[model samples]
Target: MLISGIHSRPKYAGLRVDRSGTHHIILSDTPRDIARMVEGLEPAPGPTEVWTVVGACTVTAAEERGPDGSVVRRAFRSRPLMFDMLGHRLARESMGLRLYAIGEEAFLWDVAALARSFGVDGDEIQLDHAGSERRRVFCVHCRAMTENVRTNIVACVGCGAHLTVRDHFSKRLAAFMGVQADAEVRGDLPPVEEIFR
Candidate 1:
């Protein structure tokens, strides 16, 4: 309904909007003549605050199964992941749409994507990049999958907590091996350069 006159711009794989004026936004595909009019026509608000939506995403074209029957893909996480998220967030936030997170602790922002698809002006999306990029710790009991292709942290839908790969999958293996469960992996671990690409 609010999608008219609101131009949609591609923010990475996501969407952004540019509002020209209150009159430009159309409520329907049909010409304004047949469009239903809502009462109380007031000039839309002025340039509100901007917001950002930052997240990691793995891009892969259709692929084939590997030797073990698992599809193979490229790893685009780490620095690239940060850059991608920043690009999309900046594009949309520049147009005055606030970034709203779908889940409190996850990268699932489908609602934000939908809002961007349909033009809806909103308030600020205060951006904050706190916390270190330390290795995430996944709960062994949570049955959460750790994705090495995209990011080090995985959000647990059950408990809404963030976890890391070693703290998760590798830890699961360690538990099965009857090894000590250390929050952080110790010596003999591969160098960071050799580990993450």
Candidate 2:
């Protein structure tokens, strides 16, 4: 269901550990993301630390042992706590620190934005997407965000307008733009489909 030729859509190039990195911080939500992020870097030159959210979706992020002698693992109760820890770590460490953000698009970009707040450029961090194609949609009429939208058309939570989720994505907003789908035709609207999975 992912549309090609959309420049705004994020590119999820697989993660490859930087050989020159002295320390690595992996932040992921799903086990798949963790495995993908740590695919390489076997016998890592430096220590690796994993900061993952142990929610209902994640059984145990600590089960993944790093190639570099047991990785220091920290599990959080929620995404906010995990991201808070990431922010603190980013604020403290600067040199020789490589960060990996792995999860869905929303989680990946959220990490990137937080890193930016601490003066870390997106280029400095490695991002690998995993799990779910659900989208956070931004309503054009009211500027309200409708989260976890898996269908093509949804009712805007803010203005009650029926919206068509567009492929055009906004990195700054961390959401796809949704436009009113039935404004011109009034009651006439296309059939909504659950394409994003």
- Against the unseen true structure, what C-alpha lDDT does each candidate score? 0.29, 0.78
Worst 10 residues of 2 by lDDT: 57-66
Q: How large an RMSD does model 2 have?
A: 3.2
| lDDT by residue for model 1 (1-197), tens | 01123222112221122233212211111112211132222223322221122223553322333354322222233333433543554555434334322111123222333333445324322111112222323355564433322333345444444433342223212111011123365332322231222
lDDT of 2 at 147: 86
Model 2 agreement with the true structure over 30-66: per-residue lDDT tens digits: 5454644566756654788878776764543344564
For model 2, state the Cα shift of residue 92 in Å.
1.3
Runs of candidate 2 with Cα error greater than 4 angstroms are 1-4, 56-69
* TM-score of each predicted structure versus truth: 0.19, 0.87
Best by TM-score: 2
